[model samples]
Target: MNLNNIHNVYFIGIGGIGMSALARYFYVNKKHVVGYDKTQTNITNGLIDLGIEVHFEDSIKNIDSKFLNSNNTLVVYTPAVPNTHSELNFFLSKGFYVLKRSQVLGLITENTFCLAVAGTHGKTTTTSILGHLMNECNVPVTAFLGGISENYNSNLILNGTDVSVVEADEFDRSFLTLSPDLACITSMDADHLDIYGDASELEKSFKDFSKKIKPNGKLFVKNGLPLTGITYGIEDDSDYSIHNIKIENGTYIFDVKTPKTVLENLQFNLPGRHNLSNALIALAMAVQYGCPHRQLAKALASYKGVKRRFTYHIKTQNLVFIDDYAHHPEEINAVYQAVREMYPNKKVLAIFQPHLYSRTKDFADDFAISLAQFDELLLLDIYPARELPIDGVTSEWLLNKVNNKNKRLVSKDELLLEIHKTSANVILTIGAGDIGEEVKHIKKELSIAS
Candidate 1:
C-alpha cells in the first residue's frame, strides 16, 4: 500500500525504541500520529511533547476516532506487544490495514536506496554511525535507529528521504522484511532462541536475510560469520580491514584499508575493537555508496555513539562509570574486553540484568563465563521483556554458574549500598532492560561516593 494514501497512523507498543522512531517519522511527515503504550517512558514523553497523543491504557476507547477509519488509517504494532492486546485485537476485528512495524519499514524502503544493518549485536551502533556519516556528507538520508544517538539525542535521524538507513532486527525474523540495496550483518550469533529455537535455525534466518538484498546490491559480513559477503575485521585479511591501531587519551587512532584505498589516522572514541569493526563496515558501505573517504573519516571522529551502548556517564582521574546495552554473552564479552583495555589494572565491577528468561536459560553457562571476566559481578533478576519466566531461570540460578568468587545477586533498592561496599574502581552496568532506568541514580550515588 502507498504510504501517501494513509492519513492517520496508530501505534501499539509506541514506547519501544524502534516503534517510537516510526511514530516520530510519520508525525514529522504531517500524519496524525497517536498510539498506546503499556507505560509512560522518556520516549513516549518525547512523542507527547511533539504533540502526538499517547495513552498508557490498553483500551480500544483510547484510540482516536480519526484512526478508526479502515480506509485511511494505518495500524502499526511491534511483535513485543501481546497478541491479546485490546487495541490490536480491535483493529484486527474491524478489518483495518494493520501492519507489523517491520513490514511498514520494508514498505518505506521499497523504493528508496535502503541500507540495512543486521545483527544480533552491534546493529544500533553501526546504523547510527552510518547515518551520521551520510548526514555529515550531506547525503539525503533518514535513519531509523534502534537506540537514541548521543549526537542527535534521538533515534530517528531525518536529514532527507532519498536514502533510508534502518536496523534490520533479527528478533521475529524481522530483517527479512527489508529488501536492502546495501546491507551488512555485523554478527549472526544465535539470539532470540525463544523465537528461532536453535542456533542453526537462527543462522538460516540470517542467510535468508542475506538473500533479501537487491540482486545488484552489496552485502557486507563480519569476518568468520557463516554468510558470504565482503568481509571486514581488525588486523585481518578482509576486504575492509583496520590497521595501525592505537589509543590516545581514551580514543582510538587507526587506519582503515578498503578495497579501493587506505584511509589513515581515522580517529574514533567509541571504546571497543568491536565498535571499530562496526565503524569499518559502516565506512566501507558508505565509501561504496560514493561518500568521500576524507569525509567519512572526519565524520567518524565526531561520532558520539548511541546512548546505553558503552555510554560513559562519569569519567575522571579517580574513577570511571560506564553503561551498556550488552545483554548477550558475546556482547558482554566485548564490553569486558573494552573496559579492561581502557582501564588496565583498575578494578572493574559489572552489574548485569539478563533481558529475557528464555535467553537466560538458553545461555546461562555462557553468560556465567562472560560475567566472570569482570573484577566483580553483580547480577540482577532477569528482565522479562516479553517472555514469561521459565522455571528455575533466575539471576541466582545463573549467578551460581559464574566461576567468579566475587559475585552476588543485587536488588534495585539495595544496589547503591552494595556498590559502595565493593572497592572496584571501574563500574559498568550492562543490560538491555529496565536497568537503564537506574543509571541516573547510580551515577548520582557514584559521584557523591567518589
Candidate 2:
C-alpha cells in the first residue's frame, strides 16, 4: 500500500486504545480520519478534539462520503468488532481495502527499525519506556503504544522516523504479521483462551512471535519464560537484571547488570518488581538499538508510567488508591504484590471486575487465591466484552470462591456508596473492562473522604 498517497483513513472501532493511536497518527498527518465506535469515550473525545470525525453508530450512513471511495481510503478495523458489524460488512462488501490495525502497522513500520514488544502483559509499559528511552537518547523514533503514556499524554510518540516502536499484540495472532529488528516477551501468561483454547496454544503463538525477530536482532525474555532469548529479571542472573533494589521515599532505586556492562543506581518512579523487570527489558532493548546507557538510565527515572497500569489515584501519607487493568489472575497477583509492597502497614481493599466469561471460568480458583490477599474485596459483575454470559461463571461464583471474609458483589452505584462507607486506607480497583470508567468517579469520591 502506498501510504503517502492515501488521504483518508477510517476505523471501524475508533474508541479502542490502539485504534485511537492510529487515528491520532493519521489525523496529525493531515489525513481525513473518521471512524465508527459503538460508544464514545475519553479516547473518542480526544480524537474529536484533534479534528477527527468520530461517530457512535455502526450504520453505513455514519461513514463519511470521502471515506467511501475504495481507492484512496484505507479501512482499519479492530478484531474485537463483531463479524456482522454493519460498518465493517459494508466496507467488505463494497470491495474497499480493509486492513486490521496490525496489518496497517506492519505495512507502516516495514521500512523502519521496528522494536516490537510482545507478551500477555507489560507490553504497554515496556513499549512506552522504550519509546521514551529512544527519544531521550536523541534517536529519531516513532512509537505506537497500547496505552496513553503519562509523559506524552498520547499513545503514539512521533519523532523523526528512523526507528519505530510498537506493541506487538498477541490477540488474533497480530504480532506474527510484523518482522521486528528487535523484540521482547515480557510475559507468557495464559490469556485470551477464547482465541487460543489453552495455555499451551498461547505459548505456541508467543514462540512463533519470538522467531519473527530479525536475523541479527536480539530477543529479550523475562527470566524462566520458556524462550531462548537474552533474559531479564530482578535478583536473578540473566542477560539483564535489576539488583540491589531499595525504596527511598516511595521510589524504586536499583542497579541493572547488562551483557556488556552494569548500569548502577537506576531509579524507577513506578512501584512493583514487575515494573523493574519491565524497565530493565526496555533499557536492554533501547541500549541494543544504540541508545547510550547513561541516557537510558536517566530516562528510566523520569518515565512516568502508562495509565491504568499501577496508576496512583490517591497517594497521601495515610491513603493510597491504585487503578489497574489486571483482569487475569496472574496479573491480579502482581497488582496485589505491588500494592502490598507499597503500603505494607495499611489495610488493602480490592475491587475487581472480572473481564470475560471464559477467562473467569478457566482461572476461577486462581482468581480466588489472588483476591484473597486483600483485606476487603468488592466484586462487580463480569464485564463480558465479547462473550455472552456463560453458565456457572458469574461474578457471584467467583466471589464465593474468594477466601477473604469481607467480600461482596456490588454494582457500580452501590460500589460508590459502599466505598464511601469503608475505612480501608489502601484501595485498588482492578479489571480490564468498563470498570476503568468508574475509576475517575471513585477517585474523586475517595479524595473527598480522605
Candidate 3:
C-alpha cells in the first residue's frame, strides 16, 4: 500500500517502542497521527508533546472521527494487542485498511536501501549502533529502532529517507515481511517458544529472512550461527573480527580486523563482550556499505547506548546501580557476565521481574541458573504481558530452583525495603517488564542513602 495515499494514520497500541517509532515517522512525514493505547507511558507522553493525539481508553469514542474514513486512513496494530481489542475490532469490522506494525514497516522501507537487524537478542543495540554510525557518517538514513537511543533521545532517527535502518523482529516471524538490502543476524537462540514451539522453527525463520535480502545484497551473521554469510566475532579469525581488546578507564580500546585491513585503536564505551560483539557487527556492516573506517570509528565511539540496555542510573565510588532489559535466560547470562567483569569485587544484588508466564515456564531451569549467579536476589511476580498465568509457573517456583541462599520472593511494594537490607555494593534491576518503572525510585533512594 502507498503511504502517500493515506491521509490519517492510527495506531492501536501506539505506546509500544516499535509502534511509537512508526507513529513518529508518520507524524514527521506530515500525516495526521492519532492512536490509542491501553496505558499511558513516557513514550505516549513524548508523542503527546509532539502534538500527536493519544488516549488510554479502548472504546470507539476515544478515536477521532477523521480516522474513521476507510479510504484515506491507515490502521496499524501491534501483534501484542489481543484479537478482542475494541479499537482493532472496530477497524476490522468497518473494513478499514489495516496492517500489523511489521507490515507497515516493510512497506515504508521496501523502496529505500533497508538495513535490517534480526536476532532473538542484540537487535535493539546493534540497530541503534548502526543507525548512529550511518547517520553520523552523513548517510541519508531513517532508522526505526526498538529502543530509544540515548544519543538522539528518540527511537526514530530522522536524518533523511534514502536509507532505512530497522530491527527485523523475530516474534510472530515479523521480520519475514521486509526485503532488506543489507541484513545481519546477531543470534538465533531458542526464544519465543510459545510462538515457534521449538528452536528449529525459529532457526528456520531466520533462514527465510536471509533469503528476503534483495538481489546483490549482503548478509552478515555472527561467526558461529548456522548460516552462510560474512561472519563477525571477537578475538577470532572471522571475516570481520575485533582483536587486541583492552579496557582502560571503562572504555574498550580494540582493533577491528576487516576482510581488507586492520583498523586500530577504535574506542567504544558500552560495557560487556556482547556489546563489543554488537559494535563489531555494526562496524562490519558500515564498512561493507562503503562508509570510511575513520568516520565509522568516531561514530561508534560517540554512541551513548540505547536506554535500558545496561543503563546506569547511579555510578559512584561507593554504590553502582544499573538497569537492563534482560528477560530471556541468555540475556540474563550476558548481564551477569558484564556485571561480574566490570565489578569483580563488589557484592551485586539483582532484582528481577520475570516477563511472561509462557517464557518463564519454558526456561525456568535456565533462568534459575542464571539468576543464582548473583550475590543476592529479589524475585518479583511474573509480569503477564500477553499471556495468562500458567498453573505451575510462578516466580516462587522459579525462585525455589535458584541455588543462591540469599534469594527470596518479594513484592513490588516491598522491593525497596528488601533492597535496602542488602549490603551489596552493586544494585541491578533486571527484566523486560515493569521492573524498569522502578529504576528512578531506586536510584533516588540509593543516591540519598549513599
Error of 1 at 300 (Å): 0.7
Q: 373-419 in candidate 2: lDDT tens per residue?
A: 99999999999888899988899999888888898889988989999
Q: Tens-digit lDDT track for model 3 on 1-450?
A: 778899999999999999999999999999999999988889999999999999988998887779778999999999999999999999899999999999999999999999999999999999999999999999999999999999999999999999999999999999999999999999999999999999999999999999999999999999999999999998988999998999998999999998889999999999999999999999998898889888998898899999999999999898999999999999999999999988999999999999999999999999999999999999999999989989989999999899999999999999888888999999999999888999988988888888
lDDT of 1 by residue, 1-450 (tens): 989999999999899999999999999999999989998989999999989899988997787669778999999999889998989999999999999999999999898999999998899999999999999999999999999999999999999999999999988998898999999999878888889999999999999999999999999999999888999999999999999999999899998888887898999998888898898999998998999888888899999999999999999987899999999999999998898888888999999999999889989999988998888988888999888878888899899999999999988988999999988889999999999999999999998887
| Per-model C-alpha RMSD | 0.8, 1.1, 0.7
Best by lDDT: 3
Better model by TM-score: candidate 1 vs candidate 2: 1
Per-prediction TM-score: 0.99, 0.98, 0.99
Which 10-residue span in candidate 1 carries the lowest summed lDDT?
60-69
What local lDDT does model 1 show for residue 248? Answer: 97
Name the regions of candidate 2 deviating beyond 4 angstroms: none
Scored by CA lDDT, what does every candidate get? Answer: 0.92, 0.89, 0.94
For all candidates, the clash counts are: 0, 0, 0
Order of models, best TM-score first: 3, 1, 2
Candidate 2 to truth, TM: 0.98
lDDT of candidate 2?
0.89
RMSD of 3: 0.7
